[model samples]
Target: MRITTETVAAAMKSALPNKTKYHFDDDLAGFGFYRTTTGTGTFFAEFRTVAGGSKKRLKLGRVGTLKANEAREAARKAIANAALGKDLAKSRAEGRAAATVARLLELYNERTRDKRKASTADGYDLIAKVNIVPHIGATKAAAVTRQEVQRMHGKVGKARGHYAANRAVAVLKAAYAWGGKHGHVPEGFNPASGVDRYREEPRERFLTDAEMIAIGDAMTEAETIGLAVDAGTAKHAPVGQRVVMSPYATAAVRLIMLTGARLREILHLRWDEVDLERGILRLPDSKTGKKLVYLPTAAIDIIKGLTPIGAFVIAGESAGTKREKPRADLKKPWAAILKRAGVSGIRIHDLRHTFASIGVGDQMGLPVIGALLGHSNAATTKRYAHAADEVQRRAVEAIGGKIAAALGGVK
Candidate 1:
């Protein structure tokens, strides 16, 4: 029956549990409602086709949010739009193409990674695939729920259990929700909702005095091997081979050790951001999004040998695009150096660990060390606690005994 005023009242009261009311008869073109977990609304279209008798049905709205007459009119409009050779569904796709879970990943790469930081964009890809697309990327956007979000959170929690893993999942949740919000998918999705946002427990990993010395020795040996091999490799180049390692990388590493700056801060450095005479390396912005850095003498000499031909401090690395160029990873040479120097289980980031460890070892004040590390929160700086302060005293007279002995039996 067509949804006339009388028919709508009857259909609204009708409990049609298991059948689809296919076509409209007479003035009743198309009309029916099926009870569902998602509330109720459907409209019928009685249309004639060349392939004999034909019928179609379309959803009206969630039962309570829309009135019966309102639904009837909306369905009529949808039918009219459909008749015009335009897809109402396709019109609302908002230009985002997510074919399979894999395709969503590809589109996400084009939209995010191509223009953003490599490290940042890689993170979006990793979690979106590992957590989301596998579970529900195929599910139509309208079908998501709070329970599914909880499952995703649990999955990330199970897989990594680290602060980073949970954090990655949160970012992925944000991205999916963002997709929905922008009409890439339907809105009102609770992708990041209903899951407990757990706090990361305290983690401290600064190396000890012995460990620091061992790693430094390893780094030195690695530099030796790198220098020995770099020349032979560079000579065979046909024409213009991009220089992989900067002359200042070693000294810069030393400066990272001495000053406790983040790896990216120095790695992304530019000549425009430096000041030789003022002995200051002024940053326009940092990971914190504020531009601030004070470079002491150690940072200057390390880069003094550098000719900043490109946009970065290690002098020649690329920035601003993901695929600009490839640079050498510190892995092999570092491993060779570490093996020769007899160090074990240390990463390049551990250099920062060593830096923090030294400050804690030197009897320096905790707040002072925190400032040197550029930490806004003392709690973050506190990771160096017990480890940062066990090494030295303020006055040189405290170590005069060693100096006296070095004076060749003058003592």
Candidate 2:
């Protein structure tokens, strides 16, 4: 029957609840309506590929959504294109194969697993998970534009911070570069390119002597009370009760303050990494790569006091268990310590700065302090130069005052 408005209306009204049926147009080939047993009708185009290949069907719209004439015109164009050697089905499949941001991130992680450290890889994964993926993970890699990248960068900067924004953009840049190199993204298509990055000032916060003493007192009090008790333990109270910091955590904090090592460096410190006889810590890997941290007597004593619970000098709660893993973070205990000490606006990393500050105040040479702190180069250690200058200025003022007193008595 001819596929006119009347014919389609009749098919819709009389369609049976048995099986699907097709009503092709009498004037146009391959244009029709598929009537389902539920009385629903849809327009579709049926065409062959390469004149002798398999038939392909493309759904256009529902009967009410598309008129018979419009469906016929669309089907005619589709059939004509099919006859001209285009494979509409294959093209659809290729469109589905186009790379998305999520897919590109997965590929980037896999490719850089060996090239990046576990900590570095974790940072990248965090940037993708917490920042980039939530914003545009579903967007096609090839379709991402510089405008979208800039907007994301700006929004992240406003919401998080400028430094975090810069890091997030760096992650995006690396992902796009990796994708483009591997042909996952189009050549010369880097959305992150030319997007301005936020300028970040170096943030250096050192603990004052009073703040340091207060924190030490807090840690001591914490140790006496014990850190939070383990859950499901009848021997102790429930979680959230003030308990001592695990001996490991207590000793770890002391060492960081005494030695100026990074938090992760101390948390991940293994028994094999310590050299007690030489008073040195031979770090096999660090932010600046391999380094040797020269430990003073105080630092060495702190390390000696710690009783190794597992392979790690600072063991987590899983110590001595089959599922034991080294302490990966110190967020909870550190937060509690900070609260109890009444200390604000100081971070765990600030302990390192405090150590450098004290060294400079004691008239320790910058080069010597740099070596003790395991600085990779002089430039990285230059931040402490002002502390040394302050010390020298005080010495000169004392000497000049005595000389001036003697000249006044002679006059």
Instruction: Tell me the TM-score of each prediction against the true structure.
Output: 0.55, 0.70
Model 2, span 270-355: residue lDDT tens: 89999999998888988888888778898898888877777788888887688887787777677777777889878788889889
Question: What's model 1's overall lDDT?
Answer: 0.58
**For candidate 2, what is the lDDT?**
0.82
Find the candidate with the highest TM-score and give its number: 2
Measured by C-alpha RMSD in angstroms, how accurate is candidate 2? 17.1
Clash pairs (backbone) in predicted model 2: 226-243, 226-244, 227-243, 227-244
Error of 2 at 220 (Å): 1.2
- The 0-to-1 C-alpha lDDT of every candidate, in the order given, reads 0.58, 0.82
Candidate 1 worst ten-residue window by lDDT? 44-53
lDDT of 2 at 399: 88
Where's the lowest-lDDT run of ten residues in candidate 2?
A: 227-236
Give residue 355's error in model 1 in angstroms: 2.3
